[model samples]
Target: MNDEKISVDNRDYVGALASGLEVLSAFDVQHKKMTLSEVAQITGMDRAKARRLLLTLHALGYIAKDGREFRLTPKVLRLGYAFNASNDHLDVVQHYLQSVTSELGESCSLSILDNDEIIYLVRSSAAHRLMSINITPGTRLPAAYTSMGRVLLAQLSAAEQKDWLARAQLLEHTDNSIVDKNRFVNMLKDVKQQGFCVVDQELELGLRSIAVPVFDYQGKLLGAANISTNSLRVSMQSLIDKYLPALQDAAKSITAHAK
Candidate 1:
């Protein structure tokens, strides 16, 4: 560790690398295409610094530029590819997800919490239409309003969860979205007690899901898995009663031999 050049050594600040990665991360599902000014505004970085980072990213082929706006290109996928290749466990998790989808005839996903958001690491679809947005390995969703989010959050300690809840600004994506602190806290507790979570029409109308946590052999929380389906196609009660078991089973499968 002494060889590591961290910020406190009267040298380069760790914040610089973090800020550069943040600039890359800011380009996501919604903010895929943005101008230098847009990146500056979104990331709160000065316009000059944002421009430098964007230009560097573009030159490195992680991004593409056309006129005033810039967007991520296929080269950006290399980052994800590298991550997937490095983590051999994701393949095992993906296989479990595929099994769950095959068994339940529903869409299944393996996701990990990332910076207060959930990123789908692997997803298997059962040919049934679900959320309006496409669900794929790279798909990202808000951690606050998703069953997977709640399930992953449930894995956190009570004190850490409270700290997260305090800073979180709950967005009302739909009328049913829970924005109240007490109710949200209570719901997280319920998720912990039940060992699973269900979100009904909170993320999107007709989009219902159930999620269970996946752990590693050493009992470390690895991630969460979920099955998402359309409400019209499957009743909420059935999702909780029927799909929940399948999802939890898949979680166990992923944990049993994830690598």
Candidate 2:
């Protein structure tokens, strides 16, 4: 479910807890460690509020303070571990994704839409790297510019899609990136009709990927599974004629075993 849909005025909505979690999330790969002022700036909270949250997290063993900077501790991993432990289907996804990677000789990933971004849930990397940055689990990328992201986004209802487009910042990442909202919406319609998507050098130059939505046995939408490769090494036709079938088979296997 989209937690962002929840109203802040609701009785169950704990603003302090939400703010604290937002502060924790603010420390990512780029901002690994931050001072109170830095955290406040990143999270848009006042320095005093940020300091209180940081200290509270430090007291709870989730954040560690070294001199003046605060960084996430190993205890923070427990939150991710709890998610992984509860989802038994992840192992099945990993196994099938690895098989696809071994057979196709390309990186395979499973990603779910979160807000306007797609979060990588599982990844099986081949020898070659498609992107300049490493894409591990928890890596997030713009949903509008990725094959897996498009596949997942296409599954959303019309109102949800409209809401997403209204709030999304459609920036041109590459020359091929679609910045026109109408063009993007039309592309999504095609993706939904075709039951898959192919993003060609949109997010980054020389990065091409094709994705299909994954579903459970009961037809619940799980996420999108994709095979990513360097555009220089793989052509768009090859993605459809070769990698597409293999990816579809893996998605079927995942759905069959997810029960």
Candidate 3:
């Protein structure tokens, strides 16, 4: 099992529960509704196991079955809601994110690192969209290719960051994307020292962003906050000189108020 190593040293881990959640996660935006066979293939599980898990989820109201196709139900939203409800600090982050968007006339978002991706929890979008895909709350983007992801990664310990780089599948999203592991690690070190990160059209052709990590009252990492814009409209120097100061102030305010 992919998660077996996670539980290897921890006796409290429940592999079955982990596998069940893995099965549910297989049904994403691209695979909104899938058959048992499709779910099995995506989860790397056998048909019988996948069927069992799906049926269990269906019975529990987390999934719905329409003939041979299965899709998630509204009940599944409780899982994500539970996290948001527990983290009340996110409300503070969202307030500051909206302020950044209002001041800069660009999109700003708050995201947290999840596995190898950064999941947006709060997003204040501008009238103009920067990418083909609509980026809203719940959108997940590759952490290594995003400014917000790099800011969060910069918060990790040296050994943790090194391990992530060694295990990550470096895909080049664009000509500017950093695919070299050593180079990316070095960039993370620079981000750590500078207290911010800038990704210039690395993930999407016209999208450029700058991010800084936000901390809680106890200096614990809360998440990353970023301002995103189209490269043609906003020059890199403008981002550093004009927008960076505003973002940094917002981050400091968010951290101070995060209780």
Candidate 4:
């Protein structure tokens, strides 16, 4: 079977269009306001190239300047707006995620698998912070390391999962992080069997999470939803014994009646 992607663009596949988007992506939450040198450093481009792109973006009103630094303008939001608007159920999902945060007093999020990574789309955080970096919409984490990611990954067929494991470089993010491919595969099987997963400080120190997959009314997989809390504040047993049940119940309620 042919697996190669067919090009629909008449222009060169590798061109200015790609570079401009790459430049935009390089300016994330941590590096939002950046100088030309910062943009070049983030994007791995020369200063001249980064400057040209930044200047072009600034001229187009997609970016604004303050002295020597550039930051994305409201126009950048239009891109996110388009995505939000197109996804019909995102707001509904986001509302429920917020409700979970309110009920559990923990951070809850809905994320979908994107190119082998779990990209959070809806995030409802409790008043308290959980990590050095604040959790927000569009945050991405390694799929193999997150409870949400693992539950979503469990939805993949056996063959697809095998291919992913073969290609994935399972890095140990922490001492507790699962680095062995065999152990990872077994964990996925357990997730599939149990219909939920509780990861206790596996991805990061002092952070624990439990996740369950979400499905539509017709039983189509939507994504996975998770509630994360601090380990010191929430015990490991509570995460597995209590948090997992809460998340699964929320997930079932949403799927069965959230519409």
Candidate 5:
């Protein structure tokens, strides 16, 4: 039933397959492209094993080799696509996200908490760029410093939050980032009480975002919906006064139709 039990009951589980998946996941935002030895180091696998896995993935079209580096290919998108195909609610969420973007002329997104990161499931981008990094579906950001991340984190119970923070190392990405675990916990408590979260240039300079939790008709948590804008173009008061309501309304609309 628990993760430990599942790990122990690995009679049907294929360790090699799991290691191959680990090699795939090791290629993240920071490690976008890596050499064979780098891959082996990250995955803690022998060089020969890593080389075999990388070649198999490359042959399967999931990865592409560029000079000495190997990066995930467009074919890798099929994995994320499979998730979208399985989740009908993502389509409904996307519709409302488009509506939000149309009304506010800003980027809107829906993201779910995945461990210490928030994975964007749906995004409707405005014409202007909001962050130095491109925002898109499947983008992952640190959950400790993102508006949607906090909103999703607020949904967790206190003990769960503590357990997560025990393992999470809050590296300071910016001076505005909450690096102290206790302070971040307090911030989540505030988000829980308010039913929303506003992060102001904490994750990235000049980037501000506000988010509200999304739920199904039966009140099951779906995800968090957020509006991302440039801090220079939008003030904190404006975000709370203008974008927050729109984000909350969109979340409500998505919840209504999600079921």
Candidate 6:
């Protein structure tokens, strides 16, 4: 994730709290357990500052120290649980996503745009795996490359889209990834008009996915709902003709049910 600060100039911003949260976020799937030095290196903080924050978190029961390495404790789950409990609509989303997964026998996911990435909030997986990594809630993917990302991006206003396009780094993740800025902008326009997006083997070699914007009862965009499958297993045409309707139906259901 990008380490760029969003509102440092705000008078109410607490630098210490933000730094502590950043330190906590540095521990992910790749860096589950890390020494003080490792944490300092990943967060770009000096060893002394990292040590103080780690000790504070350890005292607060968020981190556990084993020998020389520190790892997150199960208590960290309370943070996630608090988010889930606060959002009453997530249960509805999960139910409909699971329904879609069962109907189509493919992985379904809901994600919202966070900075230049899409963070998964809910997922329903099929029997088959689509990617090498395990994609669960909290998984982050590049917004410029994924179908759900494009769908969310399409919902942005023209000026906001232009600002995003200016800062986004268009990298080729695979042979099929779109790198041309003009073509990408045109594609976003089409996604905005069509109300859906389909990405074919862009993020990974064999992954194909389709996505549609999901909203609440007030027409507030909740996120993007997606169905992902192996390219060999699902054709592009089938995704539009079959999966698209299923996803659109789920989105409508979410809007009707979600507060």
- 2 versus 5: better TM-score goes to: 2
Which scores greater on lDDT, model 1 or model 5? 5
lDDT of each residue in 79-146, candidate 2, tens digit only: 99999999899999999999999898999999999998899999999998778888999998999999
Writing each residue's lDDT as its tens digit, candidate 3 over 1-259 gives 4544554357877877888999888877789999999999999999998989999999999999999999999998899899989989988988988898889899999999997999999999999989888898888899998999999999999988988888898898899988888898889999999999999988889999999998887998888999999999999999999999999999999989999
Candidates in order, TM-scores: namely: 0.91, 0.97, 0.95, 0.84, 0.91, 0.94
Q: What residue runs in model 2 are displaced by over 4 Å at the alpha carbon?
A: 1-5
Candidate 4, residues 105-194, lDDT tens digits: the string is 998999999756898888888899887787778887888889999999899999989999888988877899998999999999999999
12: Cα error in model 5, Å: 4.1
Give candidate 6's TM-score.
0.94
Query: Least lDDT summed over 10 consecutive residues: which range in candidate 3?
Result: 1-10
- CA lDDT of each prediction against the hidden true structure: 0.86, 0.94, 0.91, 0.85, 0.90, 0.95
Model 1 lDDT per residue over 100-210, tens place = 888888888878887578988888888967777777887889899999999998888989898898888899999999999899999999999989888989989888888
Whichever of 1 and 6 has more lDDT, that candidate is 6
lDDT of 5 at 156: 98
**Model 1: colliding residue pairs:** none
| Candidate 6 local lDDT, 1-259, one digit each (tens) | 5866568978868999999999998898789999999999999999999999999999999999999999999999999999999999999999999999999999999999998999999999999888988999988889999999999999999898999999999999999999998999999999999999999999999999999999999988999999999988888889999999999999999999999
Q: Tell how far residue 187 is off in model 3, in angstroms.
A: 0.9
Who wins the lDDT comparison?
6
Kindly indicate the candidate among 4 and 5 with the higher lDDT.
5
Clashes of 4: 0
Tens-digit lDDT track for model 5 on 1-259?
6555346257867887887898899998779999999999999999999999999999999999999999998888888889989899988999999999999899999999999999998999999987777878878898988999999999999998999999998987889988988899999999999999999888888888999999999999998989999888899999999888888888888888987
